[model samples]
Target: MSVLVRTEGRETAAGAIRPQAGLSTASRVAAVTVLTSLPVFLPGAANGLICAELGWSPVRMGAVLAVYWLASLSGAFVSRRAALPPVVERTLSIALFATCLGLLTAAVAPAVGLWISSAVGGYAYGYTQPHTNALLMRRCAPRLRAFAFGLKQAAVPTATLLASVAMPMLAGAGGWRLVFAGTAVLCGAGGVFLVRQGMRHGIRPGHSGARHPAATRDRGAPLRVGTFLVALSCAGFFGAMVGNGLGGFLVLALTTRGVSLSAAGAVATAGAALNIAVRLAMGWLVGRVPQVAWAALTGLFLTGAAGTALLTRPGLGAITVGALLAYGGGWGWAGLLHYAIALPYAGQEQRATAYSQMGVSLGAATGPLMCGLLFQLGPDAAWWALTAAGSAAGACVLVARGHVGPRPDAGVSPARRRPRDSPRPA
Candidate 1:
């Protein structure tokens, strides 16, 4: 009897899996960032205006947001087996879905209808993120991974800045509905462009046969346990808690402290801008800094931000600037650590699942609700909760570092590892 065995590391006739030279790493990261940023920046402000105009209660607004998160969590699971071809396909799909939903929501202008559209858009957006990470990991060289991930992270703030500038203009000129319609048009056009670029480069969905099934299969179990999971989850919780939870309330907190609403908004915007800057900086820094050290530094910054809020009554100018820099840098630092540490362990096959797990945990549903409950206790409660969460997340990184030494195989080409010889955590 003759048997056929499939050998790993054999690329399809096209070539070895590598990031397209034409699409430089900077461009690839920028593309992913732009795609992801639109949704993140637009929603909160848009939702608030819609709720007010519709006379919806906090509960109704909260439900709309919660539904979006739930959809994102669901999409994360679906992407694991969905045969996503490349980063471009993922971006195009997300953009198409989001734009269509945005346009439909604008046209319909019904509360229930908008909510449903938001859910669909949110899920599609969530689906795109893991694929972005996978593309960076598999296609880009290992040396560029940290910097690429940071560049991708920077997109969140960049989009937020764009939204901040655009949303108000659209809202003032034609109302909030016009803003949605405009976003839809912009995102759809962007998606179409990405699709064309992807085709030009011959990138499409499905594995390029560069991965070994055995190694891919083994990745599942350790990814579920071990230090990686712990660190990943902790980072997820901390990042989401700050990004979604505290971020939502920052303006309100500043207003309470006697700053005017406009000033508070500006401060918040400044922080977001700082976040983008820090993300870019951290990406370069991650290559030189240990992941544990980044986590620890992020924790210290978070603690100091909380202390500033708690221990001192600095003038609004000082307070806002301090909070903006500290929180923005902290979130950026934590995000970089999470991506750099977790990406290696995920391997090629299970990359989407591993990346999505972080999104699932960090999504708006879990993190914000817990922080909201704490906020209900009092403003101080929220501050304390954030401080504690940051501390805990930092500590977990430290603990995980103690258990897991640097992978001896780190930086070696993935192609070099024999299927049976791949490292498995004890």
Candidate 2:
């Protein structure tokens, strides 16, 4: 079902055999990571407020975002071919510009205008991943790659945390429109910076994989890669279903659980902080025992299910703990998940990452929309639906792991630490 190779490299307390990523490369990766996600959540942070003020139904809200997420998926695929800079520079510039314009549209436009922004923003959101990963694949060292990926993944919650903090302040200062306008300006500047940064760094001519003569091998051949891709796709579908569901709805969900609008934003903020911590933790955890990283999904999903159920109760303490588990535990796997998939197809990390993203986009697009429909039945039912989704997602990952054929490095997993000698037969 799958193959594993001994890890090409790793970093440690002793020293790194592979060269480490220098400060400049690391900073660039981090900056790109943050900028890519920041714009996506600017609108999301105020989703609940928008609904409350306009009396827009969740169904409509979810539908518009579903359209947005789908568009983002397309963006990833589109960016797949344009792997090098200048071309990449133009692509990112266009994407960020579109995001800026879309946010402007959302700020002033009516219902139809909101939908238009959804498509525009979604396109940019989708394109960011493949290209960004491609850059990292080339720049980051094998030893440091997993941690880099994990830290980069933390951008999601960082973006969410910013949105949470900004929304409440912006709403009070100048209403929500000011938030969109301000975020647009930030995104526009970020667009310019992204392109300039690449030029400054002296980007190489070719895309990754084939670009590096040594990395040219299609590490996992067509059938093998295809099967795992399908499996990871299913993983993306359900895992992202849960993660995005929480991201898109946590503040809104908290409000229904008796939280004040202002307080709900705080709860969302707390959840985002915990989410970042867990993603970093997952990075370290997998770096130690990557072969088993896929297995960790089961634990995270179950935690999400428990967390979602906890939220159905009626207390602030429960709400906080639940959000930590749901957001921290449920949503933390993304970085590790992406890293795991990329390790197998290191050469084609960009395109491989895109396949995984398709699963994520599919789930993200539908998760909220499905939950919106469930909310009509009652709030508890929605939580139950999330629980079901988490459970299903966990099963998909476990199944994927099982399908994997043991590679030589399988024994390197921490789980296989049994002693070779049996006490010399005592």
Candidate 3:
């Protein structure tokens, strides 16, 4: 039988058998995520090496990271109610190249280099999600959406892991400039590859790219600001605060406790690896039992809160264990959160994702800056603040759940269902 390629998959002419195209799309999404995420994380991961060269303090490190998060807020404006496939394709393509350019700038420029690099990279980071999430909603099957989101989000920790493991070693071997230059080349190549892969799915390049069937169909009604969205944003904000606040300084904090830079990076690497596993597992589980998604998120938040509290202990063993818990549990809900939003919202995925990103970016920006100040007061103070943020995230999830209506099992939005169809999870 002849193969018929759909927007997201390839099916036999009979339509009973599906090919690997869907997996290919999901893989590309994850790849792009890793590339986009890597730059923001590099500053934190290689802070010791970078700071030694620039003579930067923890506060300056925090500022550089915060600027990236703050710049991400621009995504909301760029992606406002944009449902077209061309827009998604173009924005993401530009974001990728921009990310590479920023890295290249950092590699070559002088003392002010990192600041410029952070802003440019931050802009790219901000523009990435609305498009990527839109692509996922269009391509992935409804049944697998949560898992696909999981796989996509897993790239974040994957990036962190790469940064933790590779950046320090690369800097040590060839200087930090070599690290950014190498990364820029990698990102640039990734962008080209993604654009090519997108062609099969009808996501062509340039201002006049071909449209996907999903995006060409009805452009859904604009997403309105409402209580549920507000609660979701709050949850994201608090969650990011806990995650980024501690995570940004994890290596430095470890070093302060007497671990060497290489050893600290190894610790961070282990934590990131654990985080990757947790996010992937949560995504897989939530995809099957979507009804419990919110509860799962709340549990993760509480678990992370406990983990952050563990950071208050003085021993290296305590610090190591705490970092693992904080990384794995505290920071694992993002994919699930985006999946939950995408599942019910369907057509409004881009706008909805963008809305949430704004809150997340602001919190990420605030968290590191606040934690840097707290670290000056003392590391324990910073850790405690992160613990509080995690607890608050759990509370926000509970509030969001309360607002989801009494029939949690009926996961479909009331407005989306037909009158005769029985209500059920999407």
Candidate 4:
């Protein structure tokens, strides 16, 4: 069963007061996110096999991935005006079903099927992102909210790790088609479970949670797009270029270095594992020390830059160390960033998440394209591009901090409000 917590009107020096979100609810949200994320990253994980069979170059593979991010970018922009489903379960189920369908479609013809399949997957990811954020924002305790976001965002690397580990073995066993088909089956099963839970929870179709038009309007209020928010999102854009580029190309880069596919996948898996651990740790740190959130993000990007520089060095030892640092420190702070962004917004988490997602999508789309273009110049050139992007992202975070630093409580301090008479469902 899911537990919901409504934020009290009162605000503290730390943040708003609310109960912790149920573990089951958070787990479901993460699972749905992982399922939706798979289609976008799977192409990268299985690029070698797919390219070998289809005669496509790395540039063409990058283009395919770009299409997916572009579709997500478009959807994120559109979500600014879209209404979320009444319940989180409905949204998660829809995303899961869409992901399942996309995977199944890609299984039919891994080559031509990728275009449409990836778009569908991207749409599902973009569509569900903000709704899930809003759900966590409304239901999670402010004290632990960063941790919740960390756990949720960890799903992305989890998907990438699963893809990196599973793709090669599955492809080797029965070719790439089997991999997609198997993933689709898993997605469909998850969808079914969510559907059943939604029904059991009394969230039937056409059941509007809002009692009046005014309440609905209030829930979908226009977003406050401030200069500070824009700067922060732009920082995310730059950081994603490095983070996503790292995940998308790590295996291929290692293969070029004369490592076996299985071994390369193992290295990628280690990076992803470290990434997951760091995200959770960062979230916990920021939640305990809210004052350090922005500063921690800035440091993460800088560390990512240093890691990218290491990748430019020769030998598997350098590559392994670089991948761990790059993936762990560089990409681990997304959940904290989201938590920080949503804290000041109070009730507008969905709209806030949409805008942030747009920046990430734009960065994700452009990053791989830039890397692929430079790939022809040699692997070091691609790594250098990522290094530069990571550094720029760190600078952007510093700019954002400057905007927030002068204000009381670092400018994100929630305004105090009158306490409610009693708690209620959010």
Candidate 5:
């Protein structure tokens, strides 16, 4: 329970912590990518079928999502405790178990059973994210952190791509229940792999000298609250609204506008593919550019994409391609920059809390619900609404930049410093 502060050869530049060398950064990165990605694959493909069978309306579905996010927020709060190791490990195990159980329950149960199962799964997944991020960041080298994070982020789309192909085929032959059961098996396998990997590598569960007192005392600097929070909220709202909600719905919208299902699928696939590419590109960009400038650029691209979707005629292939590029680029870039920049403002002690609060306050669930309702209004209305929201988000970023000014010396706070003397986990 003792937190040791080691300050040997640690340096901060541009608001990031440079992790010292000693860990098997590659293995840790690989572990994070696989474990974090497995849970996301099922929801993207199965949500529609589950909703249809359950007879849940958009509002109800939104509420369900809200409950899941609330659970995630709760997990984030729990991670703030100094005794985070066992708590995290137990939480991960419970989450994986719940997710598997939920999937099995959905396969066999009626509407109420499915809903309850979904909620349980969501809560478990929410609890797991912060711990995973914290563990990865603390253990990785500073120079490789962004790239490592990008690699981890890429797991999402990769999983989704696999799910898109596999889930449909499984559902066709074995019913939705079978699909759920299969997903459960995958999650269970992933959880077991992570646990075994951690144990085999001798990686302990608790803080690894990163939360020591001297580091805390030296790095306890106050952050710019008003500007940072506003920007953070904007990024979260835009991210959840477009990236999570609208991206899922875009195919239907395109099909409604006379695009063939295959074409619509192609567009969606293209966007997702571009998302993976842009995320890696953005990770590299963040290390080279001003983080705020990157944020502004992301907002601009997103706003432009929204506008294009709103103003253009539906049949133009070139325009569609351009819009997807913009949409994918903005989302991929903004997500990386948002987390990278926001980490410095929060300090290490409160980073998890800050992320959770933003998730809640931004109404992560509500964004998609609102988009769904807008779809019911009219496709054009939905497009315009997204455009307007994107514009607002972009404007907020500009306003926030004015208020906070430039961050010339932004680097990781000492409070979140990693130990210089600790041996790298093999």
Candidate 6:
């Protein structure tokens, strides 16, 4: 069997995978980002609104969010075997459109109905990352893939930023429903736009140029490789814990510590802005930095832990400092860890990313519940719980790094994987 390839903006030697020169990445990136934000939008930025409007405690809101992520678990699993580009585009648009409907339902429906909406929306959320990864893998060059992933991930913070800014403006307008309804509209519009792009610039595999020798159709792999990849997957779980956990509770955490509601929202936005900046910059910096991927992953998590612990300190100044650290450092590792997950499984981008997504989704699904349980113990204690989770995740990255060794038979071409002082770790 031949290897699959990463032929994003260029072509390979004749007789290799087909060229996708005309395929504009902007559309794919937008599609994925919009879909990704749908399920996560409310849970991340509007948690305070959700709790207030529904009259539920933080724990109750966390439970609903947890269930939403849990539902995504299945989609992540099925992503192990990826589909053709057209299939991905079709499914992605349809699922995102459906998620928009679900978001609308969550906005207007009663308590029980809202939970049902979360569940429906969750299943659609699962499809976005893996499918998007598959698309990016095919489109991005190996050298620039990290940045590509980062650009796509920037949407997370973009979504958060929008929601955070709108929190106060939209509050009490029609309660949480108004915000949720807006989410539905955005996602639905994104889907329609992507589908139109897909129709115009369709998938054409026969035109593919260069192919990865190991990125073949065969699904099975060596046990050692699978075992090593699992460590990275575990790290993904921890990374998600940092992002989902923090994003879910930051506002509440600050409010509990005596910050006003608007102040808390502003803090969340600042942190999210920092996060966005770091992620976008992290990808570009990876090329300049000498640290190996695993080492960077480990350090990012540790920084997150420290930031979480810092929130234990009193005063607005400390809280602001902690927010930047937690958001910038804690949430920053998602793209880096994602890039690492793709390395060992070099050829099999879909399968590699599926494992990574599973880890992330599982962490995201459960992190809120775990943090919420700790929240009942107070903000300081809850942060400590986050610290513990972050520490564990760092350890996993350390372990995963050990296994990132040479695979002469598979991996990128020697010229492509040329050694420098350190490998890229975006």
Q: What is the C-alpha RMSD of each candidate to the true structure, in Å?
A: 6.4, 7.8, 5.0, 5.2, 6.9, 5.8
* Residue-level lDDT tens digits of model 5 in 1-426: 111112212324423544443134433444434433444445556667767877766566556555555555555445444233532344455566677777677667746545666567655554555554554444445445555556556665666677787778888787777877777776677667656644554334453633433224435333234554556456556655555555546777777777788887877787778777766666555545534343544554465446336434556475476457545644564435434443443234234334534453244565566668787987667666666666655665555444443344433322222222211122
Task: TM-score each candidate.
Answer: 0.78, 0.80, 0.85, 0.86, 0.75, 0.82
Model 1: residues >4 Å from true position, as ranges? 1-29, 81-91, 203-224, 288-318, 349-363, 406-426
How many pairs collide in each candidate, listed in order? Answer: 2, 2, 0, 0, 8, 11
Write the candidate numbers in order of decreasing lDDT. Answer: 4, 3, 6, 2, 1, 5
- Residue 12 of candidate 5: its Cα lDDT? 40
Q: Point out the worst 10-residue segment of candidate 4 by lDDT.
A: 416-425
Winner by TM-score:
4
Which pairs of residues collide in candidate 5? 14-410, 15-410, 15-411, 16-411, 16-412, 19-142, 22-424, 23-424
Compose the digit string of candidate 1's lDDT tens values, residues 244-311: 66566777777877789998888878777777777776666654554434454445446534543441
Report the Cα lDDT for residue 207, model 1: 39
TM-score of 6: 0.82
Indicate the worst ten consecutive residues by lDDT in candidate 6: 413-422
**What alpha-carbon RMSD in Å does predicted model 5 have with respect to the real structure?**
6.9
Better of 2 and 5 by TM-score: 2
Q: What residue runs in model 5 are displaced by over 4 Å at the alpha carbon?
A: 1-44, 47-83, 86-91, 197-226, 288-312, 342-353, 360-363, 400-426
Candidate 4 lDDT, tens digit per residue, 263-358?
Answer: 997888888899999998987787677777777888898888999999989888988899998998778878877766666555556677787888
Candidate 6 stretches greater than 4 Å from native = 1-27, 43-57, 82-87, 170-178, 203-225, 288-292, 406-426
lDDT of 5 at 284: 54
lDDT of 6 at 26: 28
Candidate 4 clashing pairs?
Answer: none
- Against the reference, the lDDT scores of all candidates come to 0.56, 0.66, 0.72, 0.75, 0.53, 0.67
Collision count of model 4? 0
TM-score of candidate 4 on Cα atoms, chains taken together: 0.86
